[model samples]
Target chain A: MCELLAMSANVPTDIVFSFTGLAERGGVTGPHVDGWGISFYEGKGNRTFKDACPSSESHIAELIKSYPIKSEIVISHIRQANRGCVSLVNTHPFSRELWGRYWTYAHNGQLTGYLDKFKVSRFQPVGYTDSELAFCWILESVVKQFGEQEPDDLNAVFDYIAGLADEIRQLGVFNMLLSNGVDLMAYCTNNLCHITRRAPFGKATLIDTDVVIDFSKETTPNDVVTVIATRPLTNNENWVVLNPGEWKLFRKGELIRS
Target chain B: MCELLAMSANVPTDIVFSFTGLAERGGVTGPHVDGWGISFYEGKGNRTFKDACPSSESHIAELIKSYPIKSEIVISHIRQANRGCVSLVNTHPFSRELWGRYWTYAHNGQLTGYLDKFKVSRFQPVGYTDSELAFCWILESVVKQFGEQEPDDLNAVFDYIAGLADEIRQLGVFNMLLSNGVDLMAYCTNNLCHITRRAPFGKATLIDTDVVIDFSKETTPNDVVTVIATRPLTNNENWVVLNPGEWKLFRKGELIRS
Candidate 1:
């Protein structure tokens, strides 16, 4: 098993504080030390930084923690190497383009014998990781049903993805976070939690590291930022834990569906 | 116009020395200062770092210069935007997945009305740059000729890509560098140069910066390394300039086809 983190914001926001807490777990505070990756959606495209090294000791992760890259949507993961060997190709937060839109995905749990179940199609996995294979299958299924372009009914698309998520969950734990620079979807099989910070933002203390941040000072009243992680990063703020086999869709920091 | 840089080597090599010269051209020593990006292939998958700021001043570029992420294949670009706005989405080098392998591309020239000429198909451009549009068209054509799997006859694939490069060059100047991790292809319309360093390695000096490196201390006699750029990066070394409408394919630092 690994760890997952994601963010959806109404405005461009930095994940420095939240990511700092998660980074600690990548080798410092927790056992997830295989590798780590993060993707930040700027517009139609997103930039990703990945390292096969432990995030706590990675120079790239240090750069990420110090450099505040503001983005509306973000997805990140810290791996523990359950299924695949630790390598750059096996790093999480895998990305692919569909319907002219860049899609990013990160998974936290292992799915045993996934290759035998999933059928390969237009999209193929460059890496041997089960997470990447599952991601490729999901995109292949989407393209099969809706053709190359994104369907007119987004609810239908969400429903399709949720159904696929449940199917993937049958094999093993399948906590996942996926996005297309617009909608962020989190599906839980074992663990996932989310918290939305808005107008009356108060001080929050990190659970993993010795850090406290005043959200009110950093955010405007109009800003709505939702952060989702495999485990809650902050102790003071209440995080809504997702039940097993439950999935939620969020757009611009607001939960649109469950 | 932008600037392009690429490398192919038999052994895993760090491009810190060549990249330093190119980084200087991004703002300090030259005018191509809109944005910059680079892709380093580790295996079938590649990791890309991009910034919407000038490479000379970008924190990410600074990190790249300091941290030596060794790779066998590398593609990099610094932009002086003309067609698209200076933003992360429009930064080169653009990448997409094809045949389960990550394919990266960077271009140094423009096509005025690429949208009117090129037809969109399986692959589409996330960014509205002619370079990306041309890249999409090339991949679409490849998929049309060959299925999802890479063809066994690589020469046929290279010929197809060169044909597409010629077609895009008809619209405007189209100097490009493309790779699928294993093969590095450089297509020239106006400016492109390459230098291969091997056994008799000696001292080399950068043109844009006050830095010199002695290859004698860096490599074994068996190593073969090729560096491709929009212009000669080193002042002391003799670089081979590609002719207009010429394209070359390199694998493991050796020129396989032209």
Candidate 2:
């Protein structure tokens, strides 16, 4: 059990507003306070800031709040330890390199016996967590299926990941966010919601705190931003909660319906 | 081409004092302002802070100097780009996971046609830099030689890496620092120095900044700390410079003579 937050945008965008709401849950409003982490993808490179302390009190988290690191794809998580000990290695938003591209992953739900059932190759889990083990299993399967080259058909990759997600969902709750700087994936077994803000964006308010921002003032007409979280972050936005065992793929903030 | 700093200690130790000197070279004292990165190992996990911004003026660098994230093993670099563009991907201190352990590397010198000489397999470089390519090749070679299990004999691995370093040095300058949380390795082709501080510690002043710290007051008598850098960080301490083909291995802050 944890909390997940992710973003995909047509342009380089900062997730300070949504992060403020989700970070509040790390200790202030929710019980997930063991640790937290965030990854921001910029071009071929991405930056990750993780703290073993709760996000509500971590100095690095405070720096992340103050620093507006803009990126096109971002994935974040705040954990409440279920299986692994509280340490830096067990913190979420784990990353690996595949196809010469860095891929980031964060899970909000727990698996029952992933380490016992799953097999890992190429990508191995550095920490003792079922979430990381599942991620490693997924990547290992990807490498086995696709080799070092990314599939030419995006839909084929999407369907492949969808099948993987369905299989993982049978093990336990499998809500997670994954991205490789360009492609964003969301898989939900129990809890997850997403909202996309396009050209005629309006003001939004955080449900956790009394913070509001006018998107019109902050974004251009061409900017398209999509944010997904374990729960709805804003009070007024219409977030779409997926059905159980459902998965979706997005690129540059646009949903891939295929 | 750049400045490098590394530390290995018997106990968790912060490098704020040495980092202050090395960071100054990013823009204030020298011209390695293209990018900078530092990795601090905590148990099996490591935290890396990278910025394309100059370390002399980066807010993240300021946080690093202020917050004392103590660790037993650390590797840092400030880069002046030669083979890649001045971007976040081209930053030094590139890392990859091998045998479920995160291996960090930072190079201070340039290579001539490393892409032609080195053959990378199993591991791939996420960044377009000779340094990253070299790191990938080394890790690939390590995996190829030792398989998934680390060698029981440390000297054999050290000798293997030494041979790899010698081969790369034939291409060009190859001063670099490498670590896998348990062991720290240093190889010098041009500029590098090392100093070990233990009992009977004394005050040391920075050469790049007007800062002084009394190690006796800050450390226990039994503590052993080794600091390695492109140049001596302290003005008063005597540092041993390695020969062009010399390589040293350290474990738990003690030099491994075996």
Candidate 3:
């Protein structure tokens, strides 16, 4: 339904190369031309750029192409609307503050009957989209569970989330990627793929458009990068396909679970 | 502007502890009620949820609180619209397919005059938002630079991106975080913060909202985690503050770059 791109590297690297090829699908190669957004983590902060205009024609998009905003981790998205109206308030890669840290999230599937299931206390949807409503509901759930103090059990928390996801998936397709500032996570109920780059670099080609890049020339012996997407962006590379009802955790260009 | 939260851990951990406090800002404590999103990497994919509604009032948000969804890497976001129209097409945490992987992206700052500069050959914005246009432009640029091959020189690419970001920064505030699946890169032009968690677990408390969580009980002795945010997520924990024009790279919950 949409496209996703993410990179986790050992060094401060630019996603321009991969991003270039993916941009084609925003409106040209594929149908996810709803909107686009990308964030480059510089240091303690990040440099982000977003636009509702098509990436194929936006001047700002061109600027990002030529720019080398490097980061160890990066996330980018192009949307194909399903639940929310086509507008900025409904754009992917939504953000919020939790425990003082900035959390970023993006989704790529529809949640049937999500509106009825989700409800917030103080938070209310600004736009009429099931995706956003779901986000708020998740936040409220966490607050209710921990009651201010951060939870110490990580596995238990994940289990709880998995249960929720299972429930949501039953309604419809639910695929997504999320990161705060530290690590990245991806889940796929229908279609999702991923690639991890290590010291031994290789070549990759864009599937939507005719674009390619050699990793050997762009990385050192110590660089490790991992990318996650709803579909394989490159036609040549052996992208890892995720099974239905699958999820993965990545840190420093390595897959902890599959 | 929007808020972001991320956590990287050596062992599986739950974010509910921190999420509890963060959810407060979704309209309860802060004003980022436009929408919210979160993704947790469980095994190979991720468990993601979003809501067009406020985190405080969404049923999905409440579900997240009750859910466990423990993950080594997590990304969450709450939005305050600035660019795209308020709708689902404009939601954050956009996902796409690239290089046989799912890529996710989210942004927090605004970019003026982005529409005038971006032009995508294949990728076009489905919705009308500056964030989406930027994402497409970056994707297009990557394709243009390296055709059918991944870049071998990451440093060169980073430099190129940095230059591009500098240009974009001239337009407006550019703060962001990006990750593919391996490592994380954080850049701060304005306000962004981060903290790494390792062997020694500690206690944390939320600043924007009144919440606290102790990590020591839930983590193993060898646990290592890192958190990143627009602002320090915890008031008690010592969060690293990024300098203007500074960037940091992370790998496996450890700081690779200062």
Pairs of colliding residues, candidate 2: none
Model 2 spans > 4 angstroms off: none
Please give the TM-score of chain B in predicted model 2: 0.97
Candidate 1 per-residue lDDT, tens place, B24-50, comes to 999999998999999999877599999
DockQ of each: 0.79, 0.68, 0.02
| Candidate 1: residue B34 Cα off by (Å) | 1.0
Clashing pairs for model 1 are: none
Per-residue lDDT of model 1, residues A1-258, tens digit only: 899999999999999999999999999999889999999999786899999989999999999999999999999999999877899999989999888889999998888867778988688888888999999999999888888777789778878999999999999999999998889999999899999999988999999999999999999999999999999899888999999999999999999999
Task: Flag the better candidate by TM-score, 2 or 3.
Answer: 2
lDDT, residue A213, candidate 3: 88
Candidate 1 residue runs with Cα over 4 Å from true position: none
Off by over 4 Å in 3: A152-156, B1-258
True lDDT of residue B85, candidate 3: 56
List model 3 lDDT by residue over B60-79, tens digit each.
Answer: 66766875666766777788
> If the candidates were sorted by their TM-score against the true structure, best first, what order would they fall in?
1, 2, 3
Q: Considering DockQ, which of the candidate structures 1 and 3 is the better prediction for this target? A: 1
* Candidate 1 chain A, poorest ten consecutive residues by summed lDDT: A112-121
> Looking at candidate 1, what is the lDDT of residue A160?
96
